[model samples]
Target: MNTFAHIKPIAQYNKVSYYSVCIEGNEISLFEEFITHHTSTNKKKLNHVLDWIKLIGNKYGAQSHLFRPEGETADASALPPKGIERKPHYTEYGKKKANNIRLYCLRANENVVFLFNGDIKTAHYAQDCPNVRKHFKLANKLTKAIDSAFANKDIVWNDDCTEIDCEDDFKLQF
Candidate 1:
């Protein structure tokens, strides 16, 4: 179990991406606690990310899909190319090219928390982001404290339609 899974740090804003991190204990409801606690100061940052995720989840969950475990096959049906099945795809208006987006969901005691809305091209190195990596280390330490509690769990797809609105102010470091 990678301790990184426990780290659920809320996202900081940028022109292009939305991100969050967490490194809490793997107790039954720890995942829920992390998201509930670390909301972006600015609601927009929060809502934007949440809405983007909901947008795609709603798109796919409305259909028959497969949820593949992380360590097994990267069976991402929603994204383009489809995990090594990379190819050029076209959208309805030809406005957006079909690039693969990897929205991987992590499961913690059935909550299936940690919503990432990045594409395959970007996701390839998401786990290595400097900000994310810092919390990743923190989550690692937390997992060590908990005797590495993530040994047993299954990844699942979540489409609960989470709604987050933009905030007046948002802060990244606390």
Candidate 2:
């Protein structure tokens, strides 16, 4: 079993510093992969998605959005939020429409988040999009892996929740 830990600070905004994680054998972190792949593929749309992430990290901290209603995407009270229902240990972060690139992450702690993967959604629900569906399935599997890591003491957090002590080769199995 492998573990997860904060590797290094990737970005900082408004006093909040975002860290990156690397599963053993991978040179780039999951966050780096998302930015690189998504930006290269669709700069205009994914830019907004990335900006939203930065804004959230700056204004209310990395975990602020998690405090909102689990399924609520915006302030609209009449219409339901687009996208599929998120599962335990996973949260979707991104805007709608062209900005509908959703990044699924695991809340390792109050201020620590481990981004697993993302998908571009083109429907009212993620299940309607093959790509989004695949990412969602991957997120579920990663969630289970994280759970098992915790159970086996493969993942451990520092007292302040600002850091983690993880074993090598922490990559997701499937």
Candidate 3:
């Protein structure tokens, strides 16, 4: 399986720290790449996303709507853009928008979230859209890889769950 080579600290606030997923040989993270691409191509939408992140970090900490389940039910019927089912291992974080954007993250713990990837919602149902489906598939793959890394001790969290320490050679196997 592919493992992540590094867990780069991306942001920290209110004693909560956020991280980016980096694979071996990649200087920039998947999250950074997403930001860069969206910033240049879709500045307005990207601004909304960044603002949402800032609000989550500065105001809510771990209790923000961004980190919460998209729906109250397992099938996420509470929200229409349903793609992946909400589980403890992985969940979708998104800000409601006319042009919806969703970020997938792995729940490392109560206090830590690792951003894997995201997508732009163009339809009422995510499964009906090709890009949304592709994004969810990627999220699922990353979720498995992360779970394996956790099982193997490649990813370890500090005592207070304030930091994550990963293996230097860790890279996503998929």
Candidate 4:
């Protein structure tokens, strides 16, 4: 069976255009599902991750240093990077912390990011973690499909490489 996902625009910030995927037949986008699932159980961590996303989208852009590489392939990454700490009186500061919550995504460029779904990773490796195994695999598959779309000119970067241009009904199959 083939799985399909459509690129759904989430937010357009000054530095980047944030996006998420809506899989065929699903009511909510993957990123929305991720937020809903973790909202109650991991509120604080979720906030931290959101803060990071806001900072990237509004101020910093999707810089390479912000994402934690996730997949074996080069495309997938996660948010709320390791070693980041939440200080009481300062902006997001740095300190070692084991963040189990993973939100897999693709940092398309400094100006575009595609948010995917993820879960609490219980193991060191995504494939070994029961909770995040499917998410990780799905992220990788979607990443590859999106990459191919770009390669085939189905998805083209806008001028300045800050955004992408594609048909409104463009869908990726994996």
| lDDT tens readout by residue for model 3, 1-174 | 444446677887764577766767787876787777677666665665566455555665554344535323212111112223321112225533343566656556546667655666666555665655665556566667667777888787788876778767566565
Candidate 3 local lDDT, residue 36: 79
**Tens-digit per-residue lDDT, 1-174, candidate 4:** 988888888888999998888999885999999999899988766776787888889988998888898756546899877663532212323544666788999998899999998888889888889998899888888889999999999899988998888898888888
**lDDT of predicted model 2:** 0.53
Q: In model 2, which range of ten residues has the least summed lDDT? A: 74-83
- Every candidate's CA RMSD: 12.2, 8.2, 7.2, 3.2
Candidate 4 lDDT:
0.84
TM-score of each: 0.28, 0.63, 0.70, 0.89
| TM value for model 2 | 0.63
Sort the candidates on lDDT, descending order: 4, 3, 2, 1
Query: Mind giving the per-residue lDDT tens digits that candidate 2 earns over 11-66?
Result: 65563445555555666876687778887786765665565556555665555434
Runs in model 3 lying further than 4 Å from the true structure: 1-6, 68-99
After superposition, the stretches of candidate 2 with alpha carbons farther than 4 Å from their true spots are 1-26, 64-98, 169-174
Q: Best TM-score goes to which candidate?
A: 4
> Residue 3, candidate 3: how far off, in angstroms?
7.7
> Model 2, 170: alpha-carbon shift in Å?
5.1
Give lDDT tens digits, candidate 1, residues 22-57. Answer: 323343333243344335332333343345444434
Best by lDDT: 4
The better candidate by lDDT, 1 or 3, is 3
- Model 2 clash pairs? none
